[model samples]
Target: MSLGASDHRAIQPDNDDIESRIEAETLARMHKQLEDRRSFLQRTTSRRSSVCIYRVPPSLTEVSANTIAPEIVSIGPYHRDRDTVLKFENYKWSFLDYVLSFTRRNGNDLDKIIRSMSDLERSADATLISSADFVEMMILDSCFILGYMYLYTSQEDEPTFSIPIVTRDLLKLENQTPFFILEMMYDLMKTINGDSLELLALKFFNLKLPRRDEEILKSTYTPPYSDQSIQCVTLLQRSGIKIRRVKANSFREINFKKATLQIPSIAINDYTTTLFINCIALERCTPHIRTHFSAYIAFMSCLINSTRDVTLLGQDGIITSFSQDDQDILFLVGIQTVIVILKHIA
Candidate 1:
């Protein structure tokens, strides 16, 4: 079951990390980067997602009066406090934000959105993400991955999964839900107008409701709904799947199919700056071609990780809102990758 470093990596046939000496300074830099990963940019960036965190004070009704739950919930780091939300003028508050003044007047619109679909009596037909929400389509890839197993199975092609939801029972919205699910879901649903098969896979691979107030922070850039597939692979290894490493040549086609390709770093274009200039076109000619696409992903990841576009924020007496173009590039790559993945599926 061990999908050791060997099985996961393509360029290397064996333990790649174990191959060379650990260059100390580079490793140290990585650790430092992890530590400094949090940014003031986050503070300035406005985000509203379904995920958030909370901590419940042990009921103050006398510390030992008798505990009903008897355990501190690992649910939140809670996002839904009235005081936490700031109400803007004319009811234009952050939609994903559930905090602030809790009067019926301020939150009535949200209540309406949640209730409108509950009318779908059975969870079977309920639209989880609102029909009208605008969100990124790449997330559908993850949902497709989640539902893939069921689709391949003999389930009569009917959706048969249930994701946890808190309801307008915002009062009962607790602090903990299994995390990764909500994180990706929030990211995936950021634009729901998405009609990709990747998005529809959301029907399976559903989750137990997350505790209220816990926001899903996507630490890694995975195609949407990929969590279940990755998790399943991991668990399989744990259960003795014995994943083995093979060269990029082994998966030549699929690699290219999902890749933003680069020719090997040979001397091609003699420009003052290096762009992935020697771009050769790739077209999917056969089913076997998909295997090779992974190599392209590896190259793309390197290009993505190594290059960064650091921008000076707006013309604030000082600069502001600067974002790494790499991030935007990654999103673009994801959207494109999903289009290719779905071509075969569709």
Candidate 2:
């Protein structure tokens, strides 16, 4: 209270020094943050130099690794040698032989098929495997898948190894052999009797147009494919709209116009969660490509919130759940969970 002018002058320098230090530190922190943001934007915006077949992020798999990961069979490089998946290796080899034999019967050379796949491996950026390894993987995986599809689709009654679970495993995001590989194999062996890869795939997965909506889909199936932005099926049906199943080759083909929503038929079962999550994962990894699967899932998830929402879709034959429980549909769709996963990966 009795301080002199000299004492006040002495304290002023210390206060000024403290303020200067605080300002310097704050500026440095802000500069660091700005640099960090710039680096992140650069990384995200740049095109990927190589194709990637990614492992499911731990944040996503932690909740249900079983849901995203392959169980009965493994495809691509991600889970090819895991003990759980390797047990099917013998079966894969057997199927490969069958596919090779079938190709030979169709007047296609087995050696030529291998050479074609080897050529593809050189051009494809999807995997980092050596050329020899890539060719081998492509041949083995592609043959196995085609052979399985053939057996399943054929009318002849053979020893049946075809199961619903296998179809689910084949559709898993991590479990896919590249589509190009399958297409090549199909071209090699296709005859008038043999189906294209797309048609075979539809058959193997059992995607069918519901009889009720077939006429409407055929009528509205024209150019200018419009996307239905409505999220939920119940909302569409409530607005006096009809959900018609279409003969689309891919799940990405969903369109809406006037009073009709045209979608490819999908059968939801125990494997639905795995199938959808994997498809969404593929869309997430490939940024340049159309987010067809992700958009479809988002639209479906928006339609599904609770059991009542699921029930409404079921009533219209828009959605058919394996279990009649609405909670199962909620858990399978995992709208909030997927949104978090997508954001995290983004």
Candidate 3:
């Protein structure tokens, strides 16, 4: 019952035709994907845009997923729907009510405020939310943040919200409302003149560390800028290098001169880890922005390999850990991991 040679030859051609068809389909799909990607890149890269916020890099997040996550409350679109974070929604609503009342009393129109924020949301590629949702989000999140800051700075009683946990959430990379939004809202609602949002937020986070005098505060840190970079704080200290707390306004302001590394004065607290890490994440993700923060973190990571490094910095007043435990301090910075990451990125 064996098939003849001609029959076998005929089947072979049919098999060949099917195989060829499958390969062609695969190639077509790949080609289409490439085209789509090219189109996307073209649109996104054609113009320069301000990216005041960003998602943490997946590679970095894989190392510590919770580092950029909002724990107690969600401020932005990324974590807006998590069950754990939704509990704060009620509080946000209440804050919004209070803010609206205050703004009205101060001669600010709620509709005009919403319209302004809506216009900004339309112009910026900040979120994927629809126009209506974006305006609602802006009003709610902005009001909540302003109210929270007001209560926090004024030392008013917060009956429902946990200020400490809320502070930590606010500093998380995924939980940010843009600084411009806050600035605009502040301009519209301020009862009196005050410091900028940056300074006010810094003050709220207790990051405005005291300096010795105006001279040191004004002095800039100029790094040696070389391919050769140190790996840890202990190593630097052991090599007769000194770390000084400079009274600068920004964490990105770091300088090295005559074996002394001057970094902006930053107080270590419960929120410090999230604050600094998110700042580093932002610097890493934004292309047009300076990498000063990333460079600083990379440099610090190189300098801090172990608990001994933490101990050295702590003694020098360059670092303070809320936990006071060396291991806890080390965990917060992930210095060894950061060094490896920066090496690969560089």
Candidate 4:
């Protein structure tokens, strides 16, 4: 008898239906998880506008994939849209650089390793990857690297905030992962935030993740000011975002399904509480559509850690931070070595 698609048991010899069942269940779970993550992230837009960024470095390789295939197959095809290219490139680099060093490398179980990766392809809204099954194993190659980028750019680095390094390559990498790798990708992501960045930076630079008045963000918790009069007021004069006032009813806007992720304990107030959300059913990702996430990080850092030198704003090192909403805990780091100091003492 042919096994149903959802059967968990692996197809033993002579079972023709086993492969199809496994593939179908794999795809079903992949899409379900993607939708859940995208939905949850959208709802949290009031804070964490750019979300986290990742990068699959160029040092990943085929031999490593074969070695790790057992652990990877433990969970059939998961989200790995970006890491495919990263490993492809990295393998070439590693091979060229380490030819002499690798000749003595062991090749035990080499055939099974290569066979496991022989045929593969990935397709998803944000990426489409086609390669041998062995190639798909690149997904696990960059967990530590991704974690590094998160630690490098997270909120701990005040006034001088920056985007994670992986966020930089995301534009280029998302086009390749077959839909199967998305879940594994999300799993690796959980390791980036929290204390990773702060701890690493301190260890490397003999420095600290300076604590700005945490209360600044803690205090934006009053009621919102009733001033939607200025429909769009931009704090960054240089940023070319179109801004206008939201009149009581004259609105021309894109449709993004309304969703909210509320932290119930916090009630924050601010004169400028802005949102630019699209309510359309987003189906696919245009490769490289988002050019830069760091700009947003820089801008937010300035807001959280620096006071306005003039009405327009200040980029100098003199820093004072205040969060507009407790939810948007924009931390900042700064340096003012170039600015001349003026003395006024009695």
TM-scores for all predictions: 0.16, 0.61, 0.67, 0.24
After superposition, the stretches of candidate 2 with alpha carbons farther than 4 Å from their true spots are 1-64, 124-131, 156-159, 207-267, 287-296, 299-319, 322-325, 340-346
Q: What is the C-alpha RMSD of each candidate to the true structure, in Å?
A: 27.7, 12.9, 11.6, 21.3
The model with the greater TM-score, 3 or 4, is 3
* lDDT (tens digit, per residue) of candidate 1 on 1-346: 6677756766564554554445666788888886666554464332212222222222211221111111221122233222322221112222233211221333444354344323322222213334322121112222322223233322544335311121111112232332343334333333323333333222222222111222222121223222222222234335554322222211121222222221222111111001111111121222233322333433333223222311111111111222434243343234234434545564
Cα lDDT tens digits, model 3, 1-346, are: 8999998886775777889999999999999999999999887665323335578876667545666888878887888888888887888889887777767877888888888987878766754777788778877888888877776666544446455777778877778777777778878776453766665565465523433333332534535334475657766667788888886655657778998998765556656666667766776666566555556665666666777877777777777644556665654456336635765776
Question: Tens digits of per-residue lDDT for model 2 on 1-346?
Answer: 7999998887776877889999999999999999999998887544232334555555556545677767778788877878888888778889888887768887887788888887877767644567787788888888888888887767555336766667778877677776767888877777446566776676555532233323322233223212444456666567788877777645556777877877665667666677666666666666676655556666677667667777866776766754755666775466446655656667
Scored against the true structure, residue 104 in model 1 reaches a CA lDDT of 34
Error of 4 at 61 (Å): 31
- TM-score winner between 2 and 4, please give it: 2
- Sorted by lDDT (best first), the order is 3, 2, 4, 1
Q: Which candidate, 1 or 2, has the higher TM-score?
A: 2
lDDT of 4 by residue, 1-346 (tens): 8778656344444455667788889999999999999899887752232312222221211112221222111212333433543343444333222321221243323343234324222222123234543343433332223333334444455324332222222222322233323323323234424444334333322222122333212212222222122111133333443322222110121111222111111111120111100000010122233312222222333334323322122222111132433222321222111000100110
Model 1 clash tally, residue pairs: 60
**Collision pairs in model 3:** 221-255, 231-302, 231-303, 232-302, 232-303, 232-304, 233-303, 233-304
Give the winner by TM-score: 3
- Over 4 Å off in model 1, which ranges? 1-78, 82-84, 88-299, 305-346
lDDT for 255 (candidate 1) = 20
